[model samples]
Structures are given as C-alpha cells and as structure tokens.
Target: MGSEPGAGWEFARAAAVHSEVWVITRPRFEPLIAHALAAEPVLAPWIHPVYVDLPDWCLRLKKHHRDVYWYYPLWQRLAGQRALDLHREAPFDVAHHVTFASDWMPCGLTALPPTVPLVWGPVGGASYVPVPLLRWLGLRGAAAELARRTVTGACRRAIADRTARRAQLVVGLNDDVRRRFAGTAAVVVEPNAVVDPAARGSSGSSAPSRVRTAVFVGRLVSWKGTRLAVKALSHPAAANWKLEFIGAGPDQRWLEAEAARRGISDRVTCRGQLPREAVLAALDAADAMLFPSLHDSAPWVVAEACAAGLPVICVDLGGPPIFVRGTADGVSRVVDVGPGLPARLAVALRDSESVQRPTPSDRWSSARMPALLEAWYGQAAQFRAGRDAAGNGSSVSSEVGGLVPQTP
Candidate 1:
C-alpha cells in the first residue's frame, strides 16, 4: 500500500460503517476498489463510488513521475462538475475531498454549494528539509530541491488559502498544516491512521531484543536520509549493529558505495523494494527502525513501525515525532539533526533492549479515525446550516444533523 491511495481506500471503508459515502476518484482506481468491495460483502452497500475520467493526455501525464499536479487538478475540475450534478439530485449535507491529500491541491468540495459544508483535508502541506542536509545531494540535486520548494511553496500557499476560507472544517495531518491554515477555518491536526491487519496480528507483543538489528524502510530518495542512517551505522559504537535497507530508488548505488566505503558492507543488507508482507516480516525480526526522513507530512512507514511494536529512531522533526513515542516513554528515541546525531543514534541502537515494544494507541489506529471523521462531518454540517440560517432565514436542521446517514 503506497501512501495516498492506500489511505483513501482505508478512509472510505472506515467511513462507510457510520455513513453513506459517495467517493469521487480517478477511473483508473475503480477496478481495485471494486475488487476489494466485492470481496467484503458487508461493506459493499454503504459506499457509492464515482470515477472521474480525465482526458487521455492528462491520464498519460499521470503515468510520469513529476506531472501528477497537471492531471490531478484537471481531474478535480471534472469532479467538481460531477459533484454539482449529484448535489442537485440528492442535496448532500457535507461534501468531502478526501484524496490528493495535499493542502496545496484545490478541492472539488470548495466549489460545491455553500449549503453543503465542505470538509477539505486530512491534508498535508510541504514539510521543510534542512539545507545543511541537502549539501550531501551535490549541486544539481540541491538546486532541484531548492527550485521545487520555491515553485511548489508559492503555489501551495495561494491555493491552500482559497480552500481554507471556504472549508467549514479543515483536518490537517500535522501541526504544521494546522498552523498554516488555522485562522481561516476550524483546524484540527491528526496523523493518518494506518490499518495494516498483518502488522497488528504479527506484533505478538514480544520484548525488544538485546542484539540490535536496525532496519530502514522507504524509497532510496534523497530526503529519506538513507545517507544519514549509513553515517550513524559507521560509528564505532554501532559496529555491532546490523541494518537492513528496504525499498529501491536512485540512491541505492550511493548507499551501497557508502556502506562499502565505511567497511560495513557485510552488516548492511539492501533488500530492495519488497512486498508489504515482506517488509512487515523484516520489521518483525528487527530491534529498531531507522527512519531519519528529512521531510514528510505523515509517513505510513512510521505508523507501520509503531504497529509492529518496533522502536523507531527518527528525527525530531515532521511526522516521525508524532509516531515515535521516544526513549523517555520506553518506545523509541527522537534525535535532533546536528553534530551529535550519529552518536545519539549509536547510543539508541546500543540501548535498544531498554526500549519497550510499543503498541500504537487508538488515536493512530484505523478503528478510531472513522469515528473522528464522523464527528467532524457532523460539526461542519452544523456550521454550514447555521451560516445558511443567518443569511437566508431558512432552517435545514434536519438535513444538517444527518450529514452522514446512520448505518442502521
């Protein structure tokens, strides 16, 4: 399960239990959803899925890595029209734009009838990547990152502001996103809830191992900080620790070369990109998870690590801190990115046995997210109804209260 689609799939299933949800997504994903829904007879009845097909050129653009923004916005435009038609026929109380979970993306809900309260996000704004770390990426990589930030940040703020003003309630994936759009609307910060049954069942609640075998799982991207993890492993204190690298990307060769240069090639295992089950199995056998991601709003890997009862050694910044409970709480350790980071990581690895197996709280579990969303939908509906009443002297209390029809 990659990030957004996996999350959207989980959210729809979770939301369906308490409400009748009409999902608007790309036509490309309908088959996958249909297969899953058909397999689960109980959930099939509640969700009404509507696929918005983009033009062929836009769809082809989506196949490329960098052109998602081009296709996503165009698809949303079409979805807006489709939503308008649906609204005229059935008059929904709350309209939610769930996927493309970026605060920067203009949501279809913002264009919907104001009487239909908009719930935009569970969205994430760009997370900051330290420039000092980017120096490791060389001149070309550093320049590309700088350029991406400059362009994307400007566009994100402009569009985000537009969505904020119209949304009755905006759900942010982290405090950064909440702060970015706070005053414009009711902002609530919540991390994405991961619902990996395999991870949960496999935890078995075993104690942390004394022989430390740390694992880093994620794409071998520049910001993933695989280099940082490698640097920490090279320290004399971490000579005894073994690390398994999962996932593949451009950085694999660099990591391999770095590991060889550090003379710890034998200790490091680059497993490449494995299946989700394989990754979880690897995590199950490991003592700690090393995820020093430079920038991320809310990463699913951190959630998976926590769910598997694996203590994670991640940076103090971004979504990692929210997932890792830290050594003080006997779950994991959060380290600051600076001169002593490598030493700190070595120490954490050395003391892995002291850290207890962490059980992800209900707050981070999928079971709780739907209930939270249900409450938020209800609140947004009430806010919209109140505004409408004040403006037009018309009452819509009945429809407002049942924004999500109860599953009898």
Candidate 2:
C-alpha cells in the first residue's frame, strides 16, 4: 500500500485497539478493507469503514494529478456531511482526520459538533526547499516549487488557519509543521510512518561489505534530489559508496546520463521501480539509505529503511530527520540544506559505515503507536470535557495540553 492508504490502515488498526473506529474513506478501498478485516477477524467488530465519494463526473476530475487539488476538498465536504449523520445516530467521543495529511488542505471534519473535540493530523506539508538550494532544481522543478509555495501560502492563510483554530489537538508529522501550528493549536510532533515490529531487521543481517552501498528508494524526480545524490557520489569522499536507484520516473535517463558524464556509471545503478518485497530485499542488502527529498512532509521509505537497520542520510529539511532522530549514535546523518549540500551529503555518506543500525525499539516502531494514540485520544476527550464543563458557549483556546517537545 502507498503512504496515504497505509497510514489510514495503521491508524485505524491502532485506534480500534482501544475504541470502535469508523473510518470514512473512498468507496474503492472498501474491498481492500474487507479483505484485510477478513484476514484479521478479531478486528472486524472494532472497525466500521464508512465509504463516501463524489459522483462519477466529479471523480473524473481527479484523473490528472493537478485535478486532485479540486477533487480532495469536495470529497472532504461530502465526508463531513456523512460524519455528521453518523455522529447523530451514535455520538463519538473524538474525531481524527488522518489521511490527505497536508496542513495546507482544509479538513471538513471541523464542522462536527463543537462539544466533540477533533484531533487533526499527523499533518505536514509546511516544509519547503530552502531558497539557497533552489539552484539544484532545474527550471521546470523550480517553477513547480514556486507554484507549490504560492498555493500553499494562500491555502494556509485562507483554510488551514481556521481548521487549526478549531481543532483541539493537532498532530504534526514534523517539527516544521508543529512550528507552523505553534500558537494556533495544541500541537504534538508525531510521524505517521510506523514500522511493523515483525518486519524489523535482525542485527548483522545487513553486514558491512568492502565496498559500501547506499540505496535511494523514492521516485526519480528532480525535486527528489536524485541529481544531488549523483553529484554527492561523484565527490572523492564518497567514492567507495555504490549508489542504487530503486524507482522509475522522468529523471531516470537524466540520472543515468549524469552518472556516466560524472564517470561514476560503474558505481551507480538505476534499477527502475521494484515491488515492495524487492525493495525490502534491496534494503536488506544495502548499507544505508540516501533520501534527500526537497520538501517531502513524510516519506514512508525512511521509516522502512530504519526498520531494515539501515542508517539514513537525508537532507535536514523534512520528516526524514525526525524519523531518524531516535537512532543510536552515528546511525543517521541529517545534512543541512545550503550551498554545499552535496559536499555535506558526500561526507555523511563516507561516515555512514561507522553508524549503527536502528533497533526495533526506536520511535518509529508500530509497538509505540498504540500508547501514543491512547494518550492523544485521552487528551482530546479531556479537552472536550473541560470545554463542556466551562459551558458550550465558552470559546476554544488555541492551546490545549499534551504538547510533545521536538528533539533538537
């Protein structure tokens, strides 16, 4: 499953462990949900999925990537109405908005009864590629970044502000997002990527080799910093590392050509897109993960890499740094984004050999999520109770309690 669906499924499973969860999602996922529930019959009674979608005509608008901006909000509006009806039938203690985890996007669930506290997020999207680093992105990628910033800025002011104000608790996916919602809501830093304990790698399973290997597991897009990785690999400091690209995109040809031009074609391999199992197998065989996404809110690959006991070397801009923060000393390297990003990354790559593999007890493990969810839900319920006791007419405060401090 992709990050969005995977996050929804994980959150639903975790939430269901404590109380009944009614997941409002697209109708297409119903079959998958049914299949998953059938496989885990014990969770069937706890999970009640409510499918809500727009008409076929409206859904067609989402055929293209850009059209999703229009389609998602409409879907949220419809889902909000459905949630209202469900709440009327049987009142809910707390409501959480999980998927479509961008903070700039408006959540229609804010329309729920004022008495019922809402937990918004594991949300992100506030992270951006620094201005000094924009030179790395080609003309088209730079233009896209500009357009994204413009849209996000407008939406944050017009939509996100209101939603944050109304939410009793806002679960930010990264420090960037937590800072964005700092005074606007009761914010907590918690990533949506949770590693399955059973899938965690055993110690020495991915033992070091004479020639170190670094794996990149996202799309081969310019904004994803694949070109940057290639440039970093060209540096003498990282000459011993062989880089493998495990995804396919428009930049694949460019990456191959660039690697050849840089005279490191022998050390670089662009292995187009692979299956999940194949990706995991590749991680098992590699020494480290290099994911320098320009402005990703959260990339599931980072958490998966950590689970595989691979040290991660990522740009210090988004969710990757947060995910790797809890790893043992030298287990992860967060390169700062600036004029010499490639050089910094090259040095980090060279140093990765001495790093330790992350254990299953790290913060990203799924085992820790149940307790976190329980605490968050309890906080939301308490916030609601306090508000009710103060009287329904009492205005909601921008700050509630249970704010988790971010590690420096």
Candidate 3:
C-alpha cells in the first residue's frame, strides 16, 4: 500500500507486529522483501506480497530518475481500493493507513473509504518544523526565508480555519503542530515517548584513531551540503578531518568532481550505495556524523547516531534538533553557520577542543527505539478509540492516560 522505499519497509516491519501486513509493491522487490521479512520473526508470517498491475511499462516509467514518488502511491492506492472493496464485500474488522492522515496512504491516496481509519506519521518535509536559525546560518536565502514564512503561515492558517469549522478527530505529534491548528481542531499533542533504556546500557567503545574521520550516510545531492563538510576539512582547524559518504544519488559524480576541484581528493571518500548493514558497520569506527540535510522531516539519523554513542555535527533543524542538546552528552553544537559552514568547520578543525568527550544517554539507544515506537502506536490506538466514542467529533481527554512513560 506504500511506495517500495526503505522507510516503507521500516513502517511495514513495525506495524507487522500488531497487524497482518499485506504489502502491495512492484514485482521487482517481491523476492527480496519476502526474504528480509521472513527472517524477522515478528514480521514474517503475516507478510503478504501483492503484485502491482500496471498499464504496461509503468516500471520503465519509474526507472527514469525524473520520476516523482507521489505517482506510484497514487496509482497503487487506486488499485488497492478495488481489492479492499472486494475483501470488505465479505466482512472485516478494520483497515488502517498505519501512517498519518496523508493523501498518500493505501486508502486515502485513492478515495477508498473514510470508513476505514487511516493514520500517517508526517515524516515528510511537508510537516517539517521551520528553523529560523537555519536562515541565520545562511542555509536559506532571503527569498527562501520569506517564501517559507509566507507559505507556511498562509497554509497553516487555512488549515486551522477549516479544522475549527469541522467536527473531526485529530492528533498532533507536538505542541507546535497542535498549537498551529489549535482553534480549528481539538488536537492532542502526544509528545514523543522513549522506549528502551535498560537494554541500551553501555555499547562497545570505538578507539580513537589518529585520523579524525566522520561519516555521512544519506542521499548525495546538492542540498545535503555534504561537500561543505569536506571543504571544511581544508581549513587548518580541521586539517586532518577525513570523511566517508555512503549513499547513492544523482549527484555522486558531481560530488567526486567537486572534491577534486577543492583539492581534497584524499580527505573525502565516496562509497556510493552500500547495504544498510554495511553502512551501520561503517558508522562503528567513525568518530562523528555530519548531517547537513536541506530538507528533513524527522531525521531519525540524529537520534540513531546518539544511540550509537556517536557525536554529530549537523545544521540545526527543528525536528532533529529536538534530540540534540549542544553538549558532549548529545549533539556537540547546533550552529547557524550554513553559508559560514566552511568557517565554522575550519574553527572545529583548528580547535581540537571542539571534539568533546560525550556523556551518552542510555535513552538514545536502539534498544529503546522499539519500545518508543510501540508506546506511540499504543497511544495512537487509544487516542483514536477515545475520540471515536466521543460522539464522532471529540478531542482526547486532557486527563487521558498516556503510553508507557519509560520502558525497562
């Protein structure tokens, strides 16, 4: 029901724990995904692989780098509705979107039925938390800043007004989203929950090597600003800074050329496209993570690095910054030196003191992540059920019980 992207696999694997996951995807991934799901005990048995019927060469159309991601989900949801309609012709308990209230879920992307409750986690850039600091740091131009403020304000105001006039159930992930549409919808801010701490405990330590190496794992595009990190190494402060980029994208060749142009051919290493396991292994020996993403929704990589006990140097975006507190314990610092990226990086390079000895939090471990997600889903169900019973249009009781406070 979702695009055959890596994150879709993440959601399907997680949701498969509570519900049978019947995934509709391209024939290309049928065998590969079936194998992966079969290995995971919680995800295997209920995994149903449904073939995508297309109007001849739809896969070919998708092979073009110019393809838009929204197209496939839109087309597939339309097809899924026909199938779900047939299935419900008999009887069923419920059908869920399993994400947020998106126009792109298996049901909503096509007008299947508002009858089936759909949930969407707005992990996309649309719901991105705007950061004024990024603008100050020279991340966005004045035009971009004005556009963001104007567009976001206008759209949010319109949505807020519409939500107020309607009697509907909605849950906001944070106070910002809740307050944005406050008067319009009775939004509930079920703040993020931490899952596992005890299991996270102390991780295996990575010995410091003479070389100060950092790893950046994500798509290699112009906006990611990964080149800025490499260029920063040229600054005397970080004369010995080494980098490894492990992701595939359109701008791979361009980046290699850029590195050469900057005469940092040796400092930066580009390993375009490695398996996820290999990428995690790559993160193991690295000292820090450099993530300068231009567009991010919930940048779990920030939290993931924290859990791995790795310090990170990244542009201060609102969502990822939530988990990052500028200290040795979590994030080193969140700076608004986007255009000053080179200057700041040079400063970090020169100042050996910039690399602080971290006091890692057990909360940021992978062990807690599962528990966190589980607890969130539990609240999601309860919130929905409570609102469902509140005469069609109601807010979750402010006094309503919440998900597990802390997972052991």
Best by TM-score: 2
Clashing pairs in 1: 326-332, 327-332
Clash list (residue pairs), candidate 2: none
lDDT of 1 by residue, 1-408 (tens): 357777777777777777777777766677888898899978777788777777776565566666766766776777888887877766777877667778787676666777778877778856777777786565766787798788768877788788888888888887778777777889887776564433354332334434468899988877777888888899887876888999998888988999999899988889998987788888887878888877777888877777666778888767778767521347588888776777787877766656456654333667777788788888887886688778977754333211211000
Model 2 RMSD vs true structure: 4.9
* Residue range 1-408, candidate 2, lDDT tens digits: 577887888888888778777888887887888999999999998888888788987776567888878888887888888888877777778888887888998787877887778889899999888887787788888888989899998999999999999888899989999888898999999888877643645433334567788899988998888989999999998987999999999999989999999999999999988999889888877877888888878888888877777778999887888877855435678887777789889999877666566554355776786788889889888877687677855544422222110100
Cα RMSD (Å) per model?
Answer: 3.8, 4.9, 7.7
Clashes of each: 2, 0, 14
Candidate 1 lDDT score relative to the true structure: 0.73
- By lDDT, highest first, what's the ranking? 2, 1, 3
Tell me the whole-model lDDT of each prediction, alpha carbons only: 0.73, 0.80, 0.50
Per-residue lDDT tens digits for candidate 3, residues 125-229, read 234324533432243443565575576556545543443323233344333455555565444433232222222333324444466777788777545656566
Ranking by TM-score: 2, 1, 3
> Per-residue lDDT for 292 in model 1?
84
The reply for model 3, stretches above 4 Å from the true place, is 1-6, 19-28, 40-52, 83-95, 98-115, 127-209, 248-264, 275-278, 299-304, 322-328, 337-339, 345-408
